[model samples]
Target: MKFGEISESEYNEFEKNHPLGIFLQTVNQYHVLNERNWDAKLVALRNDNNQIIAAAVLGSRKLHIGRLYEVTGGPVMNYNDQAVVKTFADEMAKFCRQHGGLILRWIPNLHQAKFDDHGNVLETMNQAAKNNLELAEFQYNEPQKVENGHYSKVALSYEFIKRLNGLNAATLEKSYSKDAQYSVKKAKEFGVTIRKIPYAELEEFHKYTTATAERRGFKDKPLDYYQKSFKAFKDDDKFLFAELDLKQYVILQENEVKTLADRRQQLVEKSEQHLSKHRAAQARELEDQIQHHKKRIVRANKLITRFGQKPVLAGSMFSVQPQEITYLFSFMNDEFRDFFGPYLIQDYMMKLAVERHIPQYNFYGVAGDFSGQDGVLRFKQSFIGNTYEVLGTYTRVVKPITYRFVRLLKRIIGH
Candidate 1:
C-alpha cells in the first residue's frame, strides 16, 4: 500500500476501476472549480500493484470569516484496507496543509454523505472524534458549524423502483402520497405523453429548470455550471435527465383514485353544462378545467407505464460505492399543471428504477421545517423512503490563530 498524491487524470483512471464508481471522485470537479476558486482544489493519489489505487480531491483555501479550508465530495479510493484509509487520512491533512498556512481541514465524502446504515458516516465520525475537537450544534443563518465540518441528509431517492407491472394508481399514492399519485393519473388521461428527455437536450432542461427555480424562489446554478459538471463526469453518465410530456401533467392525493374519478365527473358535468354556453374564452376555460380534472386520473394510470428518452433507466444514474442517488432539480410547465406533467416524469423515473432494480431514490435536501416547504416534504415523504435527520456541520480546528482571525474578521465585516 504505497501512497502519494497524484494528478486528476491519473486519479480518474483509478476511479474507473474502483469498486465505487462516482462522479465526485473525478479530478474534474476540483479542476473546474479552480477556474473560479483556484486555490480550493488539491489532488492526492496512492497505488497498489503499481496501479493507481487511491486518489483524493483536496479542495482548500475556503473563504470564511475565520480560518477555513474546505474539502468536499471526496478522495477517490478503494478503501478495502484499514492501513490504507489511515495512511490516506494522514496524507490528506498534510496535502491540504501544504496549500495554506491555516489549519489543515478535511471532511471525507463519506462524512458528508448520509445513508441507510450510516456506517461510513459513523466510521468517519469516529475517526474525527479521535481528534481533540469540540462538537458543533445547529443554529440559524449563522453557521453553527464551520469549515472542516461535515454534514449529510438521508431520504428515499427519487431513483427508487418498487414494481412496475402491478403498480396501480393506489400503489403510486402509497409510494409518493395522495397529491403526487393523483397528478400522475391526471397527466396520462389528458393526452399528455410521458417520455424521457435525452441527455443531448440537457441544455434545454437546465434552462427550464433554472426558470422554475427562480419562479419558485430558490437559487440555481448557471448553465455553464451544469455543462462543466456534466463534462467533468459525463464519461460515466453520472448526471442524467428525463423530461415530462408537458401535455401530460397531473396532481392528486395519494391513494385517491376515487377522488380523481370524482373530480373527472365534476369536470365533465361542468363542461356539459357550459357546452351550449358559447364564448371562446368560456369554451377554452371549460376545456382547460376539464383537462385539469381528467389529467389527474389519466396520469394515475401512466404511473404504471414507462416512457423515457434515455437509452435505459440505469444509464440515467451514476454513483460511487452504489450509494444514494439524489435529484438535483426537476421541472415542468405551469400552463400544463392541470395535466400533472412533473409528477408523470417522476413516476417514469421511478419505474425505470424498479425495472432496473436500483436501490434508492434520494429527494436530495429537504428543509426540516419551513411553512412553504410542506408540499415538498410531503412529496418526498410520500415515497415511503426512510427519512433521516439532516446533520448540521461540525468543524475541526487546524490553526487556532487563523480560525479566530477569520471569525473576528467576519464579525468586523458583519458576515
Candidate 2:
C-alpha cells in the first residue's frame, strides 16, 4: 500500500460509498476550515492494484513546535485489515514529519466494543484491541471513561426499519417512549409547526441558541461558526425549527372542545334513552374525553392571551449526512419546555429520513457510561436506538518532545 495526496473530486467519489462516510470528511467541511485559515488536504492510500483503499481530509494548523495535523471523521477504510492499516499508519507518520508537523491526530470510524442499553460492554473487538497500536502511537485520553477528547466515543443512532419495522408515523410513534410520544402528540395538538430556518434568519436562531447554551451551561460557538456550517450544508442539510402559533392553538383547542362537548351530549342522550350498560360505558368515555379537552382549552386560551397571534419559536435543530441523517445539534427555549418543541422537531426530521429511505437517524454523541444518570442520554434513549461504542481518537507523535510539552500545557490548563 502507498499513501499520497488525492484530488478533492477523487476523494469525494470514493467517500460516497465508504462505509463510515460522514459529512465531516467531505469537501464542504474542508472548505469551512479553509475559511478559518486552516490548510486542508485530501489524501488517499491505494492498494497494489492501484485502487483506493483509504482516504482522509487532513486539516493542518501551525502550532508552537510545528504544524498540527488532524483528520476529521476518518481516513475512510476497512479498519479490520491490519496490514493495510499498519502501512498507512507508518506512511502518515512520515508524511507528517516531512511536512513539519508535531503530531498526526486521527480517529477512525471503527467500533471498539458494543454496549447494552444499561451500558454493559456486550461485545469487544479483539482485532481492534490488537491492531490499535499498529494504527497510532497513543490512544484517546479523555477523563471520562466513555468519551474521547473532543468527541463522543459512544454513538446513539436509531435503526429506523429494524426498530420501528415500518415507515408510517403511527409506527414511528409506537417506537418512541410513551413520554416522547405523548409530547409529540401534545406539540401537534398545540399547533406546533416545523420549517427550515432560512439562512437570513439564522441570527434569530443564534440568539435563542446562545440563551439555551447559557441556561444549559454549555459553551456556545460564535454565530459565524454556524453561518459557515449553514453555508457548508446549505444544499443538503436542514436547519429546522418548531414554532407555535398560540392563537391557532387556541382555535384548535376550542374546536376540539366543541367536538367533544357534542359527542358527550349525544352519548348522554343515548344513555338516557337506552338505559343500557354499553351506553353507560360510552357515556363515561365521552365525559372523560370532554374533561381532557376542557383542560387543554384552558391552557391554550392562557397561551393565546399571553403570546397573542405571533408564532413563537420553540426550538431549532440541525442535521446533515451521507449515509445517515444525524441530528447534530439542537437548541430549545427553556420557557417553552412544556410545548415539547424538541420532540416534535426531532420527530419531523426522523420522518423525513424515513421518507427518503435513509436507514439510520443518528441522535449522535452520548456518553458510554450510562450508570451516571445523564439527562441528555436519557432524553436520547427515549427515542429508541442502538448504542454503539467507538475505539476513540488516536495520535502519532511526529515530534515527541513537542507533543509532551503540549500535553503538559494542556494538563496545567485543565483542558
- Candidate closest to the true structure, highest TM-score: 2
Which candidate achieves the best lDDT against the true structure?
2
lDDT of 1 by residue, 279-310 (tens): 44554665565565566546545543543211
List candidate 2 stretches off by more than 4 Å.
129-132, 135-170, 264-298, 301-313, 401-415
130-168 per-residue lDDT for model 2 (tens digits): 365554565563424433322333223211112333656
Prediction RMSDs, each to the true structure: 10.6, 4.2
Which runs of model 1 end up more than 4 angstroms from their true locations? 1-3, 7-22, 34-55, 61-68, 75-87, 101-182, 194-204, 235-322, 354-357, 370-373, 390-399, 402-415
Candidate 2 has its poorest 10 consecutive residues by lDDT at 153-162
RMSD of 1: 10.6
